[model samples]
Target: MTDAPAPKHYAPRWNSDPRPDPPAVGGERETLSAVLDWHRATFELKCAGLPPDRLSEKAVPPSALSLHGLARHLAGVERWWFRIQFADEDVPMLYYSDEDPDQDFDRLDGDVDEAFAVWRAECDRSRQITTAAASLDETGVRKRTGEPISLRRIMVDMIAEYARHNGHADLLRERIDGSIGV
Candidate 1:
């Protein structure tokens, strides 16, 4: 008999709200993009079902971390790394300034829905930029240092950034509702 396909492993508990699973085998670009998207979805799922007021709640005392703030910070990061740094686009930085740099996490003003919308838009733009590149080897200048950086490096760095934030999101979500899952 022909060999059977391998069985799926490690199913996520929250099947009702599914997160994208990175391909088991794929090109580097596809793998990186899928992983990043998975992290993005994970972050969104963590914030799901919470009202705007709750979304902005610190949840954990003595810490300014919240789903709303994380959305804002992630959106700014997406724009900063992909649009501004990688594509060299002329766009104003979001939720940040020289004088008030931590505004993304510190000041939780505006509508929570609006923050998520902005974040989704930035993710779309980042994906477009990545797709347009001929290869991961394509280089972009570092605005601060004037050094070249590759698309691969940016994707890897972004993955790390999302991983760290997702961990924070897990804790914030648990403290907020006592719900937890992968």
Candidate 2:
């Protein structure tokens, strides 16, 4: 008698995303923006299909890095780097203060949906600022140090920021559930 074939196994999928793949070849601005946007989408994908408790679960012991916290922190970062620093907009800070600096990650207050909405708005504003700039060489002053920072540098730095946090997100997502992927 022929032996029974091994059963097929399929990985669980928690969410479906229509995020476009970044172009392998493109202009500097286009390439940077696309990659950044892709990272943003990846961040959201990691947090999708989870309840609020799961979203805010500090799955890893001794580290308070939840998907919810990441969402809040990233929203602040997008505002701080893009609007406040790069565009020099006179906007109020999102979730920060001198007395309570790590509020974004530490204090996971407010609606998750609201946090995401704010993040999206900040990203849209950042895109507008980037598009309006004459070149990546466009400069903005550093708040702490009286030095100029270029738009190109900001984009590269933001990409790195997202990359590091995305790594954290991967771990957080995996810990939250068996699901995993880019």
lDDT (10s digit) by residue, model 1, range 84-143: 999999999999999999999999989999999999999999999999999999999988
CA error at residue 155 for candidate 2, angstroms: 0.2
TM-scores, all models, native as reference: 0.92, 0.89
After superposition of all CA atoms, the RMSD between model 1 and the true structure is: 3.3
Question: TM-score of model 1 relative to the true fold?
Answer: 0.92
Candidate 2: residue 60 lDDT (0-100): 88
Task: Identify the runs in model 1 with alpha carbons over 4 angstroms from their true place.
Answer: 1-12
User: Which pairs clash in model 2?
Assistant: none
Candidate 1 clashing pairs? Answer: none
Q: lDDT of candidate 1 vs native?
A: 0.93
Model 2 alpha-carbon miss at residue 80, Å: 1.0
Error of 2 at 177 (Å): 1.2
What do the candidate models score in CA lDDT, each in turn? 0.93, 0.87
